[model samples]
Target: LGITFDNKLHLSGHINNITYKAFRTLNAIKRKFRHQDNDTFLTLYKAKIRPTLQCASPVWTPHLKNQ
Candidate 1:
């Protein structure tokens, strides 16, 4: 994450990093199995990617609707 001189918080970089890591994890899973059903992929995504995406949400979650 980036913090500007004006105290502005930029989370896009942090989110992008998380996305990259998650994709790497997913790609590794894909390489592990030659053939998998939709359910298996779904389970893998939920177990691996979802946790990374959903973690520490309260810290960044905006309280105001407009945010």
Candidate 2:
């Protein structure tokens, strides 16, 4: 697991990490597949970006309203 934790067990770090990774992946896909059709771009997004955002979601899900 690549999840990161602080002294208080807050998930902000983990959330930030995954979002950054997903954004980077999305940018790469956009650059490399700029001319591709929607279906192809969607396929690439599903394969590459979705997982980064959804990884280990259940284990680290926020329980507090402010989290």
Predicted structure with the largest lDDT when compared to the true one: 2
The segments of candidate 1 whose C-alpha lies over 4 angstroms from its true place after superposition are 1-7, 61-67
Per-candidate TM equals 0.69, 0.87
Clashing pairs in 1: none
- Kindly list the per-residue Cα lDDT of model 2 for residues 41-61, writing each as its tens digit: 889989999988888989788
Best by TM-score: 2
Listed per model in order, the count of residue pairs whose N, CA or C atoms clash below 3 Å is: 0, 0
Clash total of candidate 2: 0
Q: For residue 44, what is the lDDT in candidate 1?
A: 87
Each candidate's lDDT (Cα)? 0.70, 0.87
Which portions of model 2 miss their true places by more than 4 Å?
A: 62-67
lDDT of 1 by residue, 1-67 (tens): 3311223665555566666888899889999965999999999889988887777766655455544
